[model samples]
Target: MQRITSFFRFCRGRAKLKRRAAAMGFMNHHHQTAISSGQEGIKTVGVDNHNLCDFSSNSDLCICIVTWNMNGKVSYEDLAELVGSSRKFDLLVVGLQEVPRDNILRLLQAALEETHIVLGKAIMQSLQLYVFGPKNSDLLVKVELQVDKHSVGGFGGLIRRKKGAVAIRINYKGFRMVFITCHLSAHASKVEERNCQCKHISHSLFSKNWNPYAKPAHITVWLGDLNYRIQGIDTHPARNLIQKDLHGTLTSNDQLLQEAERGHIFNGYCEGTLTFKPTYKYNVGSSKYDTSYKVRVPAWTDRILFKIEDAKKINATLRFYESMDDIYSSDHKPVKAHLCLKLNKLLSA
Candidate 1:
């Protein structure tokens, strides 16, 4: 009887493994699925074919992107401020890292339900990205794209969702736009690993196979906890500068900026000025720096950046870039940026 029970257990485990493999294989199918707020509840709606909606020659889209690392903790605080509830943005792109649970999605949907609806979501274990648009807005051509590097230099099996990227592509009135959210390798020492992951994600997500026409996105917005730290600065001095509000001085040593300047990562991407302070290594539920034994040096790990395909056809203006300090639900403060995406049809012609 004992031998029979053991054999049955082994067979059950094999069945579970087969089921997981099937689910992973199904992830390759990209579907345009959206959740909208209705009188009954949240409902998933399948997007129909494209060319259903159109815009004027000179169209403008007000976009707001927010990123945060939750540190695997659940925040009971209201996320209205984090979602920029006061402003009426046409599109809201949210990226979160270290999200052990997805309860925050309900909180976010509740916060924006009155004005916006969830267009799509790409989730890979702990990394999640959600895109929201106005509830009454017109339908546009859109595609959901997600790519995960399950094996990053042999670390993928160990780390899993701690590092990966998800993207959503949208073609609005013939202009293409892509929004990507990623969580790169952590720690200041893993700068090269982060750069390599960034390059891989940027190239892999928008490849020919993902799009039907094999055309690239016109405007790409990348946001997330990139894990790049400030070099040549000790923790003590970095904290001193933070207290003195000398963010400009500290940015000179920013790893991401240095890498971009050297054309290593995000070669064509443009980021708003670093007027806000570092957004990471904060004490949970407080404004103080890390108080643990590691005493991680504060860094601007959460960021929002963008790239434009053609300057003549599209114009991007940064309206506001800031960090939410009052809400300290996690070890990292949420960073938010607002931008105006304007397209001129005359220039393209």
Candidate 2:
């Protein structure tokens, strides 16, 4: 949520948000300068770290992880760009917040149906996760979806998504991967509260339903609008640095990474290098920063981080990591990571 300070005025231009806006539309779309990446060209299959380890020389499976806080907005182009019509990625894991219902999702699936990609979706209050892949890939053995509403808000528990997580664990070709997308408490000052929700997600959400063996997933991806904001700095200076491309300095104070380093949250998870600018608090249809009165300092709220316990056995390599700039349907920019993962059969043995 873009909690603009009392001193600042609200700004949304003259645009009206579509469905799932009234209640969960607390944050509007941004028009700030977005950090874009090069369009995916013909990727060469190399055994280097950029693609995968020596094990995946054949690249048995490739997965693309995307996370977006839709803020009640929908754009078909964004979906197409994410998974691609050609079905380049074997598995597409998507996480979205504030998607009220499945209307737009159904349409998106229908569009992909022509391409023969099977769609699977799960919604928990305001949080949702969608998994799709080539129809005849036949790698899918089991899919387990879990939802937990950890924070209660809105009178009498009317709105169940103030703080919660939705997760799905998949067993493919005798290998397991648990994918989680969560909407934690927002705002800059509530770092500890967000950490608490993360703890709940790590412990309880991965119950027996996710895996019959109770063993951790060979590959685990945790991503979403984690809501970690900048600290120990003035807004004007941070904005100036970001505008000038000195964004890397801000990560040192990032609550999420720091907490992970100290074993407070995301203990075993690892995030790829954040080469792109922060994906939050932007104006709609423009390349400008959060121009609202609250002037929320730019922070990497939307993210896709992962962890692989045995990198040697299941080799998880990041081919490309970037933030989509053109899809300005929400105040937060969508972040995506392309990965090559090997499923270790021994994990289940």
Candidate 3:
């Protein structure tokens, strides 16, 4: 949940934000600057450059992670609903795959400006990771922030940007946290390829060479369109189970789960139960699955998983996980999770 702060005030205009606004040419001139100046540590985005809500004491830290594969399309009108208002969150992390345009960032920033301050974004072509913290909170900006990006697919680096990962790391009040969002190889047959990509991303991203201290993240959340499909079932049976609301039956054969169980990829990570239907390969603008000749099998392609260094030190709880069915702009539905972290007051201080 979000905490209110009394530190907000209306200023005419800040020249720093104005100069930074010119960098995002995708925005119209009439639009006020909605992006960071791309300068030193933790650039704030959107109209509110003021401090975020104070998280100064040991408190339950609420985070919301959303992952969506746009399928090269974006619905500006649905942006508000996409970032749900069911509950207030202290932090918002969004991972997108197959993003067609960069202007969507400006649009999303405008949508969340009232409640959040954009910490920053990591983008590699169509793959993007956006991080936002509570408004008027100095908890995020008081320390150094790091951004890293790496791409894992492509033949001889031909389309490297098409598949890759982006990350944002921050040591907030000595509690190190890393948020990574990635888009891996597609298709049901590319199980090995996706696993390899996950391994490569794990090893390559924020490598020891990049961090002088070589510190491991206290909490790491990896989320995005992983593209792992359900195994041991065809399109017809999978559809039947989905139609019957038996998602648990299909998840039994999920490639990502099987591989993770075998320690092949994302080992030791934990995900919320798959109670919702598969979020991929749907007919655009409809609830129906793929109707093309290929008849792509539906699967839980988009996901969010997290790991904490020591459960004894910090407590983690998954409050809720569900998909947004109303948003029909993309072939794949958007999935979101609400996570609550309880820590000792002194540790979070």
Best by lDDT: 3
Q: What TM-score does model 3 achieve against the real structure?
A: 0.79
What is candidate 1's lDDT per residue for 1-349, written digit by digit as tens? 4653464355446446544765788421111121121121111122221422122232377777888887776544537778864755677888887775657778888888788878778777777888887787665335344433222321234224466677777655455778888887777866656766776676667464555756667788889988899888899888898899886798888888876655557756778777788988888879999999998788989888888888677877676678888878788898987776677767551
Candidate 3 residue lDDT tens string, 25-70: 4433322221232212111112111433233233367788999888
Clashes (backbone N, CA, C under 3 Å), per candidate, total 0, 15, 8
Winner by lDDT between candidate 3 and candidate 2: 3
TM-score of each: 0.76, 0.76, 0.79
TM-score of the candidate numbered 1? 0.76
Candidate 1 residues lying further than 4 Å off, grouped into runs, are: 1-59, 140-161, 206-213, 347-349
- Residue pairs with colliding backbones in model 1 are none
Across residues 1-349, which tens digit of lDDT does each residue of candidate 2 receive?
2332211111122222411343574532321111122222112222234434332455667777888887766667766765555556677788887664446566567767755454466666677787776676544445443433333222113223445677776766555677888787678866656665676567666454545757666778887888888787877888888888898888786767765555556645667777788888888776678778888888888888777767667866677678888787678888887777655556444
lDDT of each: 0.70, 0.66, 0.73
Report the CA-based lDDT of candidate 2 relative to the real structure: 0.66
